[model samples]
Target: MTTIKLHNTRTRRKEVFEPIEADNVRMYVCGPTVYDRAHIGNARPVVVFDVLNRLLRHVYGEDHVTYVRNFTDVDDKINARAAESGRPISDITAETTQWFLDDMAALGARDPDQMPRATQYIPQMVTMIEKLIADGFAYARDGHVLFRVRAYKDYGKLSGRSVDDMIAGARVEVAPYKEDPMDFVLWKPSGEDQPGWESPWSWGRPGWHIECSAMAYELLGASFDIHGGGNDLMFPHHENEVAQSCCAHPEGDFARYWMHNEMLQVEGKKMSKSLGNFFTVRDLLDQGVPGEVVRFVFLSTHYGKPMDWTAKKASEAETTLRKWRTLSEGIEPAPSVPAQVVACLADDLNTAGAITELHRLASAGDGAGVLAGAQMMGLLTDALGEWARGVDLSVYEALLADTRDKAMETKDFSDVDRIKSALIEAGVEVRMSKAGVELLPAAGFDAGKLEGLL
Candidate 1:
């Protein structure tokens, strides 16, 4: 029973969140275009929204939240990559999408309720494009379907940007067929080798922005609870979504709240491949940074604030998480869950505020009380998939037994002492494990450096 407020990008106001249905909350996030690996700069929104997803489920029942993130598999960028690498589009897309999943999983992001792909939903895109054309919101010219920007009166509402301003900063080429310089594509004709579907205008693929609008409408309906992405996507990307969805539906308003997290920078500069700062999530993971550490580093700052991806920050985040994890280990599961975190997360996903409240709980509360506080704060046990208590209890139980067995089986007091010392050094305190010996990842110790001690 806590109140949550989120900043709505469309309204330019922070509004209290009320689910469309009592407990069922639908959230749609724009996902990756699978041309290559998901870079470290690309992970801020992934972690930020994941925290929101965790808080929402804790607030409502876990089953009540339906999260949908889409995959842009048929994009021109992916096609171009395929041609350059001499790989098929499917191969490139599949490889990149799997890499995205693997790296994100390492960051402890919960798998979305549904991860829809554009290619799989081609019929939905085609049907939507046809409706736009029929409804006078879209037109086909030279085997391509384009959205008429001027037709939508409130086109600039989301970004708070005027069409004239967009024209001034326009880096995109104005094609001859476009009705206006600001006009964008709904569908474009495909070449012989690229992926294409049969459509009324031509054999082609859906455009970038249209895929989300189409997929969101098809899966989550016209109005969803929250729509989210990186701030870089605000302008032409999300603005077009608002126009497309509103023009297509014209009945219910699209997502009730629009949440955009700021961009990621490397050492205070924009992260780009040409600048040589471009780094994938795997790039960090391979360097021995814990995914939990990565998640903490992302949540440590305000979502609206641009964060720097640095090794030092990641280490600092790990130390921060270690303290919380140590506090969590002191207490047992409680019958009653804590309520403070719900309100903190509800307030525009203020995870930093939630962490402060957790500090209050750990510093002053008793065992049961501290555990209750941790529950409300939503720290995954063993950093398991966002908010869920990680690792089955049987694992804990078995480890306990193992610790005891180790004590009995080995009469080498020196070895027992060595194991204990090593465990403590690695961050865990060794007692009689459930299976005879139990080993917990030392929350405070240099678990990574423990290998040398052992």
Candidate 2:
């Protein structure tokens, strides 16, 4: 059996991964808020955890693992969007949820075993809040329920910040509801127009942090093998979950291991709308950037490192994938993935290392090995291969060859240059050699642009 190691953010070190139960390995990751399209930054954690999910399935039998990523269908952001658009909250969440699924599928991610919506788990959340109130970890006042931050002695252990430090450095909500400054809401009162559920405290909705704790408890139990999300979620969101869950269920250790992938950047700068670099996964896909190329660029950097998205990397990734697809065309994968690829992944999910070994396999001319290895990393899958067939360039290649042949005889390269320029304009790379002319699709390739080029 291949041993897997992962960097446990809670422990602050890389540790060997051992499931709580060999028969039922469980993991929970924080999912999107579903108010709008998922930005490119939001897609990083999805792909990173998807790779981890695949690795676990490989090492353990596929049936033995239970992965749960929740959908935050009820959030203030959703309410805001509903109010602004004059659309019902349910309609907005449903549409955006499907959008998230489609965009992720385009990037070759497998849906998790369980995708629990927060709204579906409201009864469970209310029950958990009741238990917390009974246990003296929470209290209700002014039609609101708030968790006592000081009740949990190890409140900041996961984030390694003291409560005082958090109050100073973090954005602590200052509400005059008879509570300490650091106390967070377990449930808050909702207005008549806002989305709310009937609760003992008031007609309200669950707080942001309580949503994950309750849903995780109901689906994955109190003690799960792993919990993962972006590092940006480490401070308040995850920290609050740790506090609330442990206090509510002291018998369980919550999540045994914590994993957090680093934030993403674009062109070596923070991605922002002000910079005009912010874009969503759908935006890139619509612009002719193959989802596989996006996944490749992501795996090119380790998950723990700050990933920089650039046009140059995308172009190089496309070229490499095209070459590998050509090499492994019509070849069945090996019975198992390459050992080196698994080993690289086991070492704290060293995806970049796994990719390097794949390069070696491609260089060795082992087409089957490359195919199996790429498939394991959620690349080169049958579902994501449609982009590889953008437009069959066979006819175009033949036309270019015939035009060049005529130009050689007529001592006039005008027609040859015209075809080459049109192909380049259409984002196709025309390679003319003494042997032959090979046309390949490049980045931003649009098949519609080649309508009149013939």
Candidate 3:
């Protein structure tokens, strides 16, 4: 048995992970608000935590681990998108939810054991808010139920900021109805055109933060083993969730451990629509980037650091995966992942380090070991193997070989060089030897470019 260590944001230190219940280890990750397609940044936590989820299941029996990632179908962003498109809120949410599932599937992320939608858990959200109000941690004013931030002493403990400093730094909504500026909304009234449910306070919807606390409590109990999301959620979002959950149910700790993966950048700049680098997971997949390649590139960086996505990295990942696939072709995976690889993953998900070990295994020609280790990290699976197959390079190989043969006799390699350059430009690895020429698709190989080369 291996010990798993994770950096807990709540404690602000890396500690050994000990679940509350060894028989059932539960994890809850803040899922996407389904307003539109999930961007590449959104996919980072999905892949990052998916690796952790796999590790947890492997360490514990598969049946013992329960992963829950929620869908925030109720949000201002979803409402605005619906208003802009003149579509019903339900229609927009449903379509976008499916789109999210499809996009994540393309990235090779497995669906969580329980994916509770915010809409589906409306009753639970209402019940939690009612309990908060009854417990004097929340109050209703002008049809809005707001959590009393001061009521919870450890309000700023997660993000490590005092309430006064947060009030000064944050752009809080100055509503005349609220008692304190730091107090966040538990429930807000919905317009007639907007989505809402009848609650004790009014016909309203749950605030962005309350949805997670309620849903997680409902599905994963009052406290779970691990709670995770991007570090960007560490501030008001996660902070508010902690305050409400702890106040609403003081008997149990909210989440035993907290994990936050760092943000993502593209080409050394933050990925944004204004920066012209903002693209969805679908955008990359549609542009001919395989989902496995995307997953590989993501795992190349540590989750705690800002990962930069570059065309060059994607190209290299594709090439490397192709090589590994070839090396492990027709070889059955070993019964278990290499101990070295498991140790790396257990140390706060050191995927980059694990990949280095995989490279060493490949170099050692240990195909069975490489396959087992890569699969442990959610790579080299049969499902993601389609991208590497179904392409015939024998024709190009013969053509390059014939050109090399002629170049040997004529002593003018210009024509051969031209053909080789063309193939290389199309992302084909050109190998010319005394025996013959071998052509294999490298990163970003375009089969269409090979049409006229032969």
Candidate 4:
């Protein structure tokens, strides 16, 4: 059992985790703002975090981990889209949420243990907003509500920006209702046609930051073991979330460990749909990249490093990854996953390091060991995202062809079972990968046909 140390964005240090409640990991990931189909930028966090989730399950018992990722179904974008499309807000949210799910599924992201919707938690948001106002952390004006930035002493700690610097650096809308330019919206009034909810602060919907704060509280509780998202959210979004949650419950720690993955750039620039450089998860899926390939590309780099997407680059990576599966031809049970691979994953999820180690293991002529090492990382699954794409299955397919004939023509009942047993001993999955007694010696297997008594 390897001890893991994760960089906690809150305290600015990598701390060895001691689960507050012991064995149970209360982890929360900032989920998608469901106003449209999620693009590649969105999928990076999904796969990266899913890897984190996977590593944790492999580290701690899966049943002991409580992973909660929320759906921001109610948002300004959802409202704006509804107005322009003449669709009901609920319809827009539902449609966009489904698109998000479909896109994430395509990228091979596992569904979180809990997916709390903002629309469904309006009451929770209201309760948090009301408490903030009562506690002098938030105020109301002109059918709107604004969170008082001055009230939270350490508001900009997460992003390393001082309060004054943050106000200057941020590109937030300068709404007239705000008491100060730095004061972010807690709730804003909506028109009759727009999405609205009856709240203490006029008839309006919850603001962006408050919704997450409320959702995390409702699902994971006041403080949890870890909270994660993309680096782009460090400021106002996560910064404000820290403010609201801490101010609401002054004595409690909102989230102990904060892990944020870096952004995915496209062609050396930030992935922006407006710039036409953004590709949706579906777009890449259609390009013959397996979901695992996408996950592999993401994990191949340190989660904190900027990853740029290019068709040529993705293709090259697909080839590089496929070379790892070189010798399942003679295998038995799924290769016993290597300990070093598991250790790399446990260490703040240094996926790139783990992959390097995987390649090292593969370059070893020990085919059995290589199979075991790769299988442990869960890279073999097609559900692993686009990483599985463009894999050259030629060699493996040849092995499969040989196995089929072997499983077919055996007239001796005793011989049939014994041959299948040998295939399993070779780490060749009989039903899944290569089945039957069909023997095509790998590039160099003793292809001699042996006549033996069954």
Which candidate wins on lDDT? 2
Q: Higher-TM-score candidate among 1 and 2?
A: 2
Model 2 poorest ten-residue lDDT run: 383-392
lDDT of 2 by residue, 1-454 (tens): 8999999999999999999998899999999999999999999999999999999999998999999999999988999999999999999999999999999989998999999999998999999999999999999999999999999999999999999998889677788894899999999999999999999999999999999999999989999999999999998999999999999999999999999999999999999999999999999999889999999999999999999999999999998888788788888998899999999999999999999999999999999999999999998888888888645799999999999999999999999999899999988888999999998877677788889888
Q: Any idea how many clashes model 4 has?
A: 32
Ranking of all predicted structures according to TM-score, beginning with the best and ending with the worst: 3, 2, 1, 4
Which stretches of model 1 miss by more than 4 angstroms?
365-380, 383-454
TM-score of each: 0.83, 0.94, 0.97, 0.81
Q: Can you list the residue pairs that collide in candidate 2? A: none
Deviation from native of the Cα of residue 209 in model 1, angstroms: 1.0
Indicate the residue-level lDDT of 358 in model 4.
Answer: 70
lDDT of 1 by residue, 1-454 (tens): 5667888888888888888985779999999999998988778888888888877887787999999988889888988898898988899989999999988988878789999998888888888888889999999999989998989999898999888888897786689998887789988888899788898888888889899998999999988889999988998899999999999898868988899998888877899889988888898778656777777777767797788877677656665555555556645756665456556677888777766776676677444554564444434455542322242234443544555456577754565566566566655645563335545443344535554542
TM-score for candidate 4, please give it.
0.81
Model 4 segments more than 4 A misplaced: 273-276, 329-336, 365-376, 382-454
lDDT value for candidate 3? Answer: 0.92
Of the two candidates 1 and 4, the one with more favorable TM-score, higher being better, is 1
Q: What do the candidate models score in CA lDDT, each in turn?
A: 0.77, 0.94, 0.92, 0.75
Give the lowest summed-lDDT range of ten residues in model 3. 445-454
